[model samples]
Target: MGFFDLKAECAICNKQVGLHRFQIANKEWVCPECFKKCGFTAMTPIKTMTASQVQAALQEKEKSAEALKTFVATKKSDHF
Candidate 1:
């Protein structure tokens, strides 16, 4: 009967997620922390993704972050 009673468990982190959460295609909830790690935005079609897809997206984001760390700009281009 309380707000906390409606909380859902995150499929990835297994933590209790608040009302402001994301639901996957299979209806499993995702916590804010895990959502942030996936780098998803409001424009992302997350509702159509499965839990495994979400996990894959998170792993892809981590790889992209690691790759970015070693990236260097060899040339700067200016467009008028």
Candidate 2:
């Protein structure tokens, strides 16, 4: 078997995730692309989130991005 043959399918995208895979709380592996959609940083909660929660977070991310398009800053910070 080749190096790529050891890849497993991502729980979310169903894509072949290679060695660099993220295992979620439920023990499901997620692909790099799908994990990017999560936008999670180096936080403990990320490791506790299930595949469904990650999917929900992705949806929320999309909605938040859409909402930000029309966001207006009414007040500016006095100090940086």
Candidate 3:
């Protein structure tokens, strides 16, 4: 017996579809009929953040941390 049994219904046509014929995304089982009706000729592809974008995000996070640290240090010194 298979460990996983895949079964789903087309969102558009309401026809039963085997798991192998379609894909699940965002908790939705997208059948070919629904995909075609939605005008999606190809499967949605995954997107990866670019290295520069990632680096920029990290830099912004680090800047926020530094600002927080400076604020905390000033507040502590003032209390003492």
Candidate 4:
């Protein structure tokens, strides 16, 4: 009793892809076969980074901000 819907149609071929066997293309549901024939590849992975990379970048920015804060705090007044 674990049925699912599969009535979604492919955008390029205008064919039913059965929901579980299709990919998204330009906001339209497309069958995998047609997706390949259109020379499209998923860019989600390449556009995003891993958690560790994001963490390291955030830490580096924090360190730079702390350095700037200390530098400004200990500065000797040139006027007055």
What are the models' TM-scores? Answer: 0.79, 0.74, 0.34, 0.37
lDDT of 1 by residue, 1-80 (tens): 23345778888889987787888887788888999999998888988999999999999999999999999999888985
Judged by lDDT, which candidate is best?
A: 1
Tens-digit per-residue lDDT, 1-80, candidate 4: 11255476655457777755443323445566654543436743312443344335446666877798888465778799
Sliding window of 10 residues with minimal summed lDDT for model 1: 1-10
- On lDDT, the stronger of 3 and 4 is 4
Give the backbone clash total of model 4.
1
For residues 9-77, write the lDDT of model 2, one tens digit per residue: 787889987788777776677787887887876563666788888889889988999999989999999
- 1-80, model 3: which lDDT tens digit per residue? 12145666543345777764444333334455545434444544312333243335446666877798877433335565
lDDT of each: 0.86, 0.78, 0.47, 0.51
Residue 20 of model 4, lDDT score: 54
- On TM-score, the leading prediction is 1
lDDT of 2 at 62: 86
lDDT, candidate 3, residue 45?
39
What pairs collide in candidate 2? Answer: none
